[model samples]
Target: MPYSDKIERRLHLAALVFLCLIPTFLLFARGAADVSLVLVGLLFLTRSTLRHDWAWARQIDIAVLLLALLMLVVVVAPFGEYPGKNLSRGLIWVRFVVFYAAISRWVLVDKLAIRVVCYATFAALMVGALDGVYQFITGYSLLGGQGMVANGNRLTGPLDRPNIGSYLSKLAFGVMALAFVAREQLGEKRPLAIGAGVMVPVLAVIFLSGERAASVLTLMGLVAVVIGLFISGGRARVLSIFLGAVGVAGIGLLLSSSDRIAGRVAALGAVVSDYADSIYGQLALMGWRFFTQNPLTGIGMGSFEKVCRAQQPPESLQFGCYPHPHNIYAEWLASSGLVGTVPWLAFVGIVIWAGLRLIRAGHTQTVLVALYLATLNASFFPFAATQSAFSNWPAILAWMSIGCAVAALNVFKRSCPTTA
Candidate 1:
């Protein structure tokens, strides 16, 4: 290879390695994951500049730019509860955009890179799910240090918290995408068998993790995938049957296992039965109050907790001050006001449009499109309880999925009937 070509190849390989490590980092070493993200983004930019290539920026929609700009604009809001934090957060918000573009524009633009990332992510999830299963059976976790109970019997798996269900649920869609691409490239037969074999354990683990929001959002994602696949008209019936069987079996296992999961389900039922008296209801109401008071700029990123603490909820209702509103919409409204919230909602709409275009354009890429759409539906399902949009760990996962979705759409547009 020419010296310049060799240099570019090395950089691409290194970036792909880091992309694969992101899932593992999110699972265990988050600080390391942050460093890896920066490295990947920088590497991508350096290679593109050296080669005079701007393909990575081509699919970057206006909504992404608008949101990045809004983050900077919000830094100057007079109502910001923490100006220093807001300014710092605003400046670094571009990193996510950069990372996302790198994944779609260059790293995941080809079959080899897509296959590598897909397998790596699948292995990481299986390890985490198996570890969670061990903890559930033994009442101890291998990577989470000491076992602790939250909301009764929720499992933590590898993390130090009970949110592993959310973690698994969020990334499960990415795995589906990865597996589809990888399988297609390998010319694998028995697609339904492969998909069911891979996903049944993941579905079961999420159900057993005892996170109500995670479980609900996961099912919603599955529904989206099924509907998309059905409409695209390829192996939809077999896949749907496999998924239905998996769901019935998973529910039976959950019920027979113990009262551990059962108690959490009953808690969800109680919340639905009397939502106004629930803690989520109180926190959501407080978030609405923040938006109503500062309709234009809101309080600013990372300011929700500081602002929420000062205004106590009704004493008669269950409530606790949280870092961010548990809903993404509420978080945006409270933290960045209408300016931030409107742009985000529009960005989501754009994503949906892009995914639909993929479906309508060709049937060859139906499985990939289905899985990518599933990821988006689950990640941004408006009603699902969520983590802080600005938080490092979850945000990293969300952005990675978004990048993959964009990459898939780009591939569909460029090489749909043949390469896809």
Candidate 2:
């Protein structure tokens, strides 16, 4: 190859490596993940500028601009008191856009890059799963004492919470499923077995972590895959049904083995029955109150704690002030109001529409991306108590998944032009 060709290949390889490491890095070393993302994004921008390949970079999608504008408005809106803090938070959205653009461009142009990412994510998840197992066996993780025990004995590997492990395992399941689909499509046998074997331990760790939301969402995703298999109407449908049965049995066993899991499952009804009395429920009520008070522009991003403190009923005050509403939709309305929420709702609608379009057009490769995004969405649904959507960790993961989905769709279109 010519020197220029060699240089280009090296750049693409470096970018691919960084992209692959992002999910795992976020679990253990979040600062390093951010640094890797920045470095990779800068490399992509620099290379595009040097070679006059500005087509993709210059397009600047309307969704990106709208979100950035909303963040800016949240910072400058009259309700905002901590302008400096809000400004810093707003800038993270810009970084997200840059990261998305860079990854999308790389994955779209190089068909194999997506596979690299899938394999890398699987490898990282394996490491995390192993740590969880080690923690389970010995009451401590191999990586020192980063283990967390929730509700007395529920294992939370390497992180401070069981929910994080549960979340990561679900993501790993998505990647492994993608890998299985890809290998099946390509008529590969060994990789199919490997993917299946990897998933058993991963699922075990998820159940061991004892996060109800993650467990429910994961089962839902599996159901979707089974339905999709039937819809596709192939010989694989019978096998899919068999696997689904096995998965159900495994889940039953998990629930039976763990009292915490069984108790959580049993409490689902009480949770619903007393929704209005729960701390999360009260937070949602307070969020709505804030939204109503400032329906145009919200109390401002990052101001939920202050507003909640002032407006919460004395009984609700006993729950203490939360940084933001746990639900993503409520957070948007409470912080940015309709001005921010309208665009966000539109963006979400478009994503769902696009994913359905691809699935309807028979793009199997896009299914995993769709499943991952769907799980993330379900996690942030109004009734679900979750991390702040605008926070660094969730925001980064959300944008990264979006970028990957866009790239997957683009690749699907290029490979099957008539269908897409």
Candidate 3:
């Protein structure tokens, strides 16, 4: 019966693995296209709940569920005029909570988990990278793809989009983790083959993703892993550092002349412009405006634009719409207000606490995963959580963090089996 349960579990998880990217893939889709991903995720959750073998929500996922409830409260709080948008935001909140939980608990829990996600990420990365390369060569996207690159050798996978960094971050972690597991299970044929098969594509895919930040992250992650290995008496310190440096440099060189990288760096100087400010700065101003107008409850979900227009400098209001604060903290305060802010902060505080605890326990891999997550959080701000709920970010990251923790804990188990 348990065997049957595990089989069923895998089946549902495999379905989730395939279905997870539907939202991102729907970028071409317009008008409530994002809602489709939400619906699909709900169905996935329903299936998971009805399964006999499945337990109640995984502990890590509870935070996301809480986020969903809080979003619902904010949406129905009667603060803003945009009921439709607020409700929709609430729906997205619930959906991401479910999506994150399903993936964390079912799809992305094991060694097979990383492989499956990697395959999907690799496909997308390859297509986008190759498309960019082709555009650079022939001067066009697959079919009239616009703004692939303006005036540099760099490439953009999808126009006006910059999410490949987060994907790359996860992939780098996945590949390194996979390599670790593969070598650990070296006597086993299956792990060996899977790891060997994935290593090349993973490298090629990250290269093509063309995310300079991600390239840096990948190097940083590998270096951390190496330092971890030697510290744990698991592998040679110099070997790890030497190899990590080589990999990071190689990726960085590939993207060095990329306009995407160059342009982003140039844009940094314009990040907080007062007059010629970027959209991000204006969004910040808008966020502050919304918070000021509705300090207690906020202007409701998705009301950033409405509230912004009402208060933004009329000249700026004449420019265009504003959706979200590019900064997650600013956005959350505007939508969720102080009431919702407490839980969000608490959740982050807990994650930091857990990570610190892991390090203190001398769980080398935990420290590695934690450090990666910390540095990544600094750079990306919420790890895909803005679009997702609080639960979703950790859900995705938990796989690597938990896997590393478990593996490291195994090392410190009651009896480190002596080679009798």
The lowest-lDDT stretch of 10 consecutive residues in candidate 1 is: 186-195
Q: Rate the local accuracy (lDDT) of all candidates.
A: 0.75, 0.66, 0.49
- Per-residue lDDT tens digits of candidate 3, residues 46-122? 66655643453536435644664565565444555576767665655655555544554555444555455445544
Candidate 3 displacement at residue 344 in angstroms: 2.3
Q: Residue by residue across 1-420, what tens digits does model 2's lDDT show?
A: 887667777888888888787888877877878877887777787777667776764443535445645555553354555566656666655666677778766643453765667767767777777788888878777764755565545666766556555546446544544454455443334544665676676777776666666666666666766676655556657867887798889888977887777887777657678878777787788889888887877777788887666765545575888898777788888877777777677666665565566665664544444454554454444466667877777666666666655555555456567755
Number of colliding residue pairs in each model: 0, 0, 2
TM-score of 1: 0.89
* Candidate 3 segments exceeding 4 Å error: 1-17, 20-40, 47-55, 58-64, 74-76, 110-114, 136-138, 142-147, 150-154, 158-167, 170-236, 247-264, 269-279, 317-321, 363-420
Clashing pairs in 3: 154-258, 154-259
State the lDDT at 8 in candidate 2.
Answer: 70
User: What is the TM-score of each predicted model, taking all chains together?
Assistant: 0.89, 0.87, 0.69
Q: Looking at model 3, which ten-residue stretch has the lowest summed lDDT?
A: 411-420
Better of 2 and 3 by TM-score: 2
Per-candidate Cα RMSD to the true structure, in Å, reads 3.0, 3.2, 6.2
Compose the digit string of candidate 1's lDDT tens values, residues 1-420: 699899988999999999999989888998888888989989988998999987656443644654645654654344577778877776676678788778878888777787677777777778788888888778878877546477447888888788788878877786566556555554433432454565766777788888899988887777767666666555776767676676667777877876887888888998878776687776777788999998777788888877766666534335667888788888888877777777677778877777766665566666677778778877787776788878888888888877776775665566545432
State which candidate, 1 or 3, has the greater TM-score.
1
Top candidate by TM-score: 1
